[model samples]
Target: MSTPQPQTHQQAAPAPNWQSAPGTSYTSPIPITRTHLGHALTSEWTKIKSVRSTMWTLGVFLLLVVGIGLLVAANTDSNDYADVPYTIPAFFGLILGQICLITLGVLVVSSEYGTGMIRTTFTASPQRHRVLTAKLLIFFVVAFVVSAFAIGFVGLITSGMHGGASDNKWGGTVLMGALYVSLLGVLALAVGSMLRHSAGAITAMLGLVLVPAILPAFLMMSESLRTLGEKMTEYNAPNALAKIFELDSENGGGGSQLVLLVGVTAAAIAGAYALLERRDV
Candidate 1:
């Protein structure tokens, strides 16, 4: 009777299949696309244009440049241009307005870090160098364009009103000044990337831009350091821009300033890339 109870046979459970069957394939729901530098450029452009900091900084910059420039041009007498270049007044405004570009440049990269958006940026684009490059390129182009326009406008108005013989050099000087500002901005961007903090990066850039000019004045107390101080004052950012405007007669040509700025910017950019690759987001 016990032996007759049920067939006493149980079907064996099928063994689990860990591998896909031959000739079968699995498809993912997410679509994947290859990313390139253009994608990063577009992303950075969108970021720079969308942010309020960019608008506010650039707006103030334009106001300082154009407004002060016009005021200077209005106050100048035609006789004043006999000894001075028509474009000289533009420097009065540009020296102050250049700070705005430095601020914007720091904000461009540091703001993202401050807000934790950089993590998302890196997530979207894993190539840190590409992201940095895109940021530098976009910021430089925008800054240069805006600066060129502002400086050129001032030069045009002043030249028209004063009608100087050296008006021919206005265009070249404006171009050089704009490039100088743009390179300073790129340097700021590099510093921001290296620091990853808006306030710290901005402070560092301000020191970089202004300290050389100021420190040399105090250092003149020491006769031993007077030469060094003079050199710093001569080669500082303001002096560089002044040289371009033909305001600093003691300094050498703008070519040296441009070369120095380019070399410094290149070094900062290289350091930024190196630090970014080595650090965690």
Candidate 2:
């Protein structure tokens, strides 16, 4: 009677759990993989170029960079090189180029907060640290390109102004100048993250980039302070970054890594990363 009642369906059994080796560290969640990092970088780059502000900032930077070089070229008389060390004044663009870099840099992260898109960003990509790394990567890439463009145009325009053959020295300056300008964005982005406010980050950036630039000019007024500050601006500090591209001075007191440069860059980035990942959006 039981055999004739009906055949019952049998279900598959659940899989067994495997245990890990004892005393080994266990991280339930792994970091984002390289593939994810690449995807995030691509996404970030797309986001950067799609914005109108990016275009506007880029346009303005190019204009200022090119404009300053031409102005310096036009103003250069024999007197320009009479007392100063370098023959070409094109490197002068470094000063003006920084403004554009700072503005764009702030917008990079602050813009996200402004539009309330940060939540959307994080929601889509929960691996928050990877997002930051992507932003950093994209910023550097953009900076490198913008720099090449600015330097290339300046060189072409000032070709006849400087008699010194466009040798490796000039090449080095151009490259370094571009890097310093671009890295400013990284610093700005960090501050933007930490303060989570554009105004605060921008103000801090001004304090860092602007103060160091003008300090050298003021130091000239007082011999003792000038000597000490000159040591700071010209070489003994983070201003040495400029030297990598040959922006250092003839007297060896011209430009070293401006102390603020390294400190600002490091502090801003770390603080930003911590605040960004640890806190709620």
Best lDDT goes to which candidate? 1
* Poorly placed runs, candidate 2 (over 4 Å): 1-35, 77-87, 160-168, 213-228, 231-248, 251-263
lDDT of 1 by residue, 1-281 (tens): 35665557789999998788899888789998899999999999999999899999999999999899889999987877664566777787889999999999999999988889999999999999999999999999999999989988888898787765453456777788899998998999999999999899989999998899899989899999999998898789888888888777565658788999999999999999999999998
Q: Model 2 TM-score?
A: 0.72
Clashes of each: 0, 12
193-224 per-residue lDDT for model 2 (tens digits): 77778888789888876576667877878877
lDDT of each: 0.88, 0.70
Give the 10-residue window scoring lowest on summed lDDT in candidate 2: 79-88
Lowest lDDT 10-residue stretch of candidate 1: 162-171
lDDT, residue 257, candidate 1: 87
Candidate 1 Cα misplacement greater than 4 A, ranges: 1-31, 163-167
**For every model shown, what is its TM-score relative to the native structure?**
0.88, 0.72
